[model samples]
Target chain A: MHTVTVQVVRPIGDDIQKKAAERSAVLLLGCPQVPVQTSIALYLLSMLRKKGIKGIIAGNPAARRLVEVSDPDHHYVGEVIDIDRCVADLAEKKRDFSLCFAFIHNDAGVSYAATIGSLSGGSLVALIYGEHPEDVAETLTVPCEKIVVKATHNPMPLKNKIDEVLPWVVSNL
Target chain B: MGCLESLKYEILLKNASSKESGDFIRNHYDEVHEVEAGYKILDKHLIGIPPIAVGVEGDYVIFPYTKPCYGTFLVRVAVPEEVERLRKRSK
Candidate 1:
C-alpha cells in the first residue's frame, strides 16, 4: 500500500466554524472485484483527510473488507459502511454529505456515483477506471466531475490523477 | 451469526417456485424488476461484487441483490459459505 499522510490545516478565527462544518465527505467505493479498487479508495481517503475533510467509506461488504485488510493500522480507512444501508440513509435524508468520491469501473459503477450525487445534493466525482473508460464516460449523462485513470491492479495512475485533481475536488465542492 | 441462526431469516433460493417469496423480496428490499437481456452486460459484471441477500433453495442458494451501479441480479450463488462467512465477519 502507498503511504500518504494528510496535514490537517485548520483556519483561524471566525472562519474556523464554517470550515469545520464543511470538513465532511463520503468516500464511495465500487464492488471490490479488482485489487486496485481497495488501494485507490484508501489513497483518496488519505488525501481527503489531509484536506481536513472527514471521510466515511461506503461499499459492499467485500469492498469494505478490502480497505480494512489493506490497512491493518486503521490509519486511512476510518469508517466503513454497507452500500445499501448508506444509500438508504442518503435516500431518507438522514445524512446530508458535502461531497461524494465514487470509484467506478463499469456502467453500474457510474449509476451508483450519479445516484449518490443526485441524492445527497453534493458534488459527485466519478473516479472512473478499468476497461473501455471512454465508453463508460459516454454512457454517463448525469452531470458530475469525471476523473479517468486507466489501470487494473496498480493504484499509481489514479493516485497521480487524484493529486492533480484534489485541489479541484475541494475547490468545486 | 451462525448458519442456523442466520437461517432463521428468509433465504431466496435459486429455484424458488413461489411467486409470493419473490414478491416479498421485491417489496421489502431495493429491487430491480426484470433485467432485460440487453442489460445482461450489467449482470455479467455484477458477478464480481458482493450480493445483498442469499436465496436458499432445495440444494442451493441464489444471491438476490441490487446495486446503485446496476439493476437486480438474482444469480446463482456459487459460494454461499463464503458469502455467509463474509457477512459474519462484517458483523
Candidate 2:
C-alpha cells in the first residue's frame, strides 16, 4: 500500500524555532480552479511576513501548485500542508496558528476557513469577493472577520481591501 | 498513523450522530477506503449541500470526508482492475 505523510513544513527565516511558535498565520486557498485565489494568498503572505508574522499556506495539490509555479525563484508560496492534514493537526493540537485568512468564493472555502479558524484559536478572517459579496457572507456559518471586495476573476480589486486589513496583521491581533 | 491507515468519517448534522452518517456514506459509496483516523463531520461543501472531495492517485482514490465536530478524513480507495484500466486510458 502506498503511504501518504502529513509533514509540517517550517517557515523559512532566522530564528525558525521562535517564529514557528510566535504570531503565526495560516493562509488557506480554496481551489486552483480560480486563478485569483493564488494571487490573493501570495499577496497576503507577503503582507503577513512584512509584519513579522510567519505564515503558512494550505490547500490541495492543485492549489498549492498554482502558488508554487507563480514564484519559482522566490519562496513566495513558502510552506504548505495538505488541507486535510492541516485540519487534522489543528484539531489534534499538533500545530497552532495565531491567525487564519481564508479566501471564500464557494461553500467549500467557508467550511475550510471555519475549521482552521476555530482550531487555531485565533482570528478567523474570511476574504470574500466575486460577484456576490452578501451571498457568500451568508453561506459562512462560523464567526470570523470579513474582508469583502466585489471582484470576479480578477485580484486587482482586492488591493484596497488587503490594505484595509493590513492593520490586523501589524497589530497581530 | 492508525487513524491514517484506516478511513473513517464523522457526521456533522446535529440530528444524526457519526455512526449514522458513516452508515449512510458506506451504503451509498460502495466501499470505505483506508484512512488514518475515525470519520469526521463534513456534511456540506456548500450551505445545505453535502459533497465529498475525492483525490485520484494512480489506482487509488483519496476521499476527503469531514465531520463538523471532529475534523476531516483522508481515505484512500482502490479501484478494481477493469475500472483502473478505463481510468488509465481516459487520462
Candidate 3:
C-alpha cells in the first residue's frame, strides 16, 4: 500500500479566514506553487505537517505570512511545497494520500479550496463555521458533510482539526 | 473545516447513504439548488442528470470542470429561468 502523510487544519473564525485569504493572495502575486486562494493548500499544508511529509511553500512574502498560521515555529515554511512535490513526485509509490482537512470561516475561501481540490483530484473539503457561516450551496458540485468544531478560537488549529476528523477520514478514505 | 453540510454532501456522493440521499436534498430544495448549480428537485428525471462532482459553500455550490468534458455527458437541470430560455429556444 502507498501512504503519504498530510495534515488538516481549520482556523474557525471570520477574521482569520479573511486574513488567510489576504495573506495567500499577497503571496500569490508572482508565486507559481499554487493559488493563494487555494484553501486546499492551507488544508493540505496541515496534513503534510501531521504526517511529517517533506513540504515546501512557493517563495513569496505572503507565504511568509501563512507561515504565521501554518508553522509558527517557522521551520516548516520553506519545506511546505517541496513536501507536496516530493509526495506527488512519488505518485508511483503505492497508495496516494486519501484525505485532507481544512478550516474555513467564509464562502469565498471555501470555493477556492474546493475548486483547487477538484483540480488536484478527488480530495475532501470541509468548512468550519464560526457559529454563523454564510449558506452558499448553489455554487458547489461536490459532496459536503457537516460536523461540529470546538475551539478556544485559534482558527485553523492544524493538529486539532485533524484529530477531530480522523475518524471520518479513516472511515471515508 | 466548517460548512458542515457541504462536507456531508461530499461524503454522500463519495459513499452514497441510500436512506438520506435525495430526501434531505429535497427538503432543502432552495438551498440545495442554490449551492448545487443546474440542479433541479424533480425525482423522475434524476437518472438523466449527469453526476458531476459537487461541493457546497453555505447556500452556493461549485462544479469542478469548466468546459463540457469529453468522456462524460450530463443533462443538467437548470433553474427555471434558464429552463424557460431553453424551452423557448427549442420551440
Report the C-alpha displacement of residue A38, candidate 2, in angstroms.
1.1
Task: Give the candidate number with the greatest DockQ.
Answer: 1
Candidate 1 per-residue lDDT, tens place, A3-107, comes to 999998765764865775577788888767756788878888888888778889888877887789889898988878887667667766778678888787764
- Using DockQ as the yardstick, the better of models 1 and 3 is 1
Per residue, candidate 3 scores C-alpha lDDT tens digits across B1-91 of: 2322234322222222211333344444343322222222221101112232332234333222211111111123223443343234336
What is the C-alpha lDDT profile of model 3 across A91-120, one tens digit per residue? 323223344332333333343334334333
Q: Give the CA lDDT, 0 to 100, for residue A26 in model 2.
A: 85
Expressed as tens digits, the lDDT of each residue in A1-173 for candidate 2 is 99999998766665654754488888877755655788888888888777767889788888877788887976665677877777777766788778888877665565677556656778888888767767877867667788877876788888678887779555756
DockQ of candidate 2, scored on C-alphas against the true complex (2 decimals):
0.04
Q: State model 1's lDDT.
A: 0.63
Docking class of 2: incorrect
Question: Highest lDDT: which candidate?
Answer: 1
Estimate, for each residue in B1-91, the C-alpha lDDT of model 1 and write its tens digit.
2333234233343323123334544565442233211111212212212222333343334443445444444444344554444345446
Against the hidden reference, what TM-scores do the models get?
Answer: 0.63, 0.61, 0.34
Candidate 1 Cα outliers beyond 4 Å, as residue runs: A1-18, B1-65, B68-71, B74-91
Between candidates 1 and 2, the one scoring higher on TM-score is: 1
